[model samples]
Target: MSELLEQFSAPPLIELESDLEALRKHAQKVLMQHGFPQRKTEAWKYTPIAALERRDWSSDGPDESAARTESIELPFDAHRIPVHNGQIDTSQLNEIDGLHIEPLRAEQIDTSAYVDHDPSDAFAWLNLARLEQGICIRVTHTLERPLALQFSSSDQFKQAAHPRIRIELAEGVEATLFEQHRLHGSGLINLVMDLQLAAGSSLQHLMQRQNDESALIARTEAQLEQAAHYQAYVLDLGGALTRQDLKVHLNESRARTRIHGVAALKDKQLVDYHTAIQHRVGPSHSEEDFRILADNHSMGVFNGRIHMLPGADDSHSDMNTANLLLSEHARINTKPELEIHAEEVTASHGATVGQLEEAARFYLRSRGLNDAEALALLKFGFAAAAFDALESEPLRQWFTDRLKQAL
Candidate 1:
């Protein structure tokens, strides 16, 4: 743990301004005090970081000229922001009306809310301490096209990079955010994202990630105000080591959020997802559905938790997770929890893990489809249902096509 910490605490690749330097120093102090999570940590027990600790960060990374890999081609037109090897290429940023992009301000970052005294939040603190690039995006009106954030790493990339991003939506604004990650090589990318939604605002958030070698760790925190609505859809194919934590806070009455995600894993990949939704006021609502399909020697983990605070009367929430193990060696751990402390509040949670039904597979095989084809169709059908609530037809179709290919 100390070795890894030393590597992460090395001098920043880019010099920091005075305000950012102070924040970084504080974050570094807190991180060093807590260190990293160990095997006994409940939240990290199933996910190991031994591989990350073994990495040698002394090698020179990819050449700066070759760091920018080709941008991913999107099915729909969008205002694109391309980040290559953890560096945003400002030249590629598109100018769109009603949208603004600028460097992240030191005042916008507040790490006091994180549980820094514990190792569970060590990665979040590490991100703040070693952040290389930071950006803030603002949306003030309905967007004609989606805003796409494309992140890719080169094949020779071998250094850890930290990037922070914040998205702010003004009151009564409506927009769509499409985030894609394509990672290669054997480096690490630690990311932190903040989402702020004002009153009467609506945001459609979509995420798609595919990686096989690199390690990816990310945390996303969102706060929604009165009458704000936030919908998130995530599709993660697989990776060598992937861990994501998503938390949403409904701070005012009538605020609502829905999350739907699917993780498809194969080979020796590992993917862990932890999501929490908090109803802090009266009459808020939240719904979540996540599915995982693990094949080969892969392992998958999902933990979904919902909390209704004392003053959150009339709040309602539902959470569910379904998992399938496609091979004898594959493993899955899923847990759904609900904590309610308010009167008249309603909450429900469930989780299930099982293999494919033999009877259904036999029926499909008897109908002329080969064994492999039948299996693919069944898996696709099971995973695709999670995205049924997506509003955009094109985006839904895109997700469907990607899922089919992934299977």
Candidate 2:
């Protein structure tokens, strides 16, 4: 325990803003009560932190070096916002009406508005305390084009980056947002994203994280007002250790939210997807669909939880998890939990983990295609459930092509 403290030096209170300082003190108090998350911690049970402790969390904030760097563009048409090591590069921000993108200072942000106080969420605690700067996004009117946030992180030695994002969507407005997390070197990335949707708003969010020899911990927090709708999809491919946590609160009546993802893993990679949805009021709905493809010695975990609060009458919630393992050593753990307090709510969950059907493989082989090709096609078919849910056609094709390439 003492060694862990030695590895990390907490920032002095004087260096933090008044608002941030208060949050930091609470975080510090929590850390003192519960040290870094251990295996016993429910959320951190599947993730290993020993590899993360070997490195140092130091972004040093942003500097002139960010101005000279360039972000690699994707094969999509959208307004791009490049973030280097968790800090947005203002020089690369494009101009767009009804959209405001800029740096977020500690003094200007309300920590409680985004992240909840979770004593067991070590990465979020660290993000709240060590966050130096981040990107803030606000959408007033309906957006004309999709907005993409390109996150790139690289470090020669073992380092860390904590990038924070706050998004606000106005009432009756609708928009699409994309995030691409591209890791270039060996390091740990702690990312936090908070989204708030007003009444009658709609938002579609897509994020893809691909990395090698790196560790990542990401948390997404969202709240939907009355009659609002939010749809989100995430694709996680290849990482030393990666865990993505999504928590959404349906605070008003008639709110709807859907979050799904695919973690196509390979080699010795590890990926864990955790999600929680709270139906706090009546007539709300939530659903989660997650699929995994584990090859080689990779491991994947999916934990979906649905909660119906006391007043959540006539709410509907469902969760489905499916995994396809291609190798004998490949493994996956899936759990779907439902807690209901209201009598009129309907909730259910299902999970399945298996390999390719030999009978189907034989049928395809008899049709002239080889075994490799047959399995590849079958794997693609298995992922179609989540693929078809994607709102972006180009992304759907890209993800399909990449999945084939991995095979």
Candidate of highest TM-score? 1
What does candidate 2's lDDT look like per residue over 144-228, in tens digits?
Answer: 7878888776644245666788888999999888888776566667888888899999988887878777677888888899999
lDDT value, candidate 1, whole model: 0.89
Enumerate residue pairs that collide in model 1: none
Tens-place lDDT digits, model 1, residues 50-121: 789988777776886756557786879988888777877656455767888888989988675699767898
Runs in model 2 deviating more than 4 A are 10-16, 56-73, 102-119, 155-157
Instruction: Look at candidate 2 and give me any clashing residue pairs.
Output: none
TM-score of each: 0.97, 0.90
True lDDT of residue 45, candidate 2:
82
Q: Judged by lDDT against the true structure, how good is candidate 2? A: 0.78
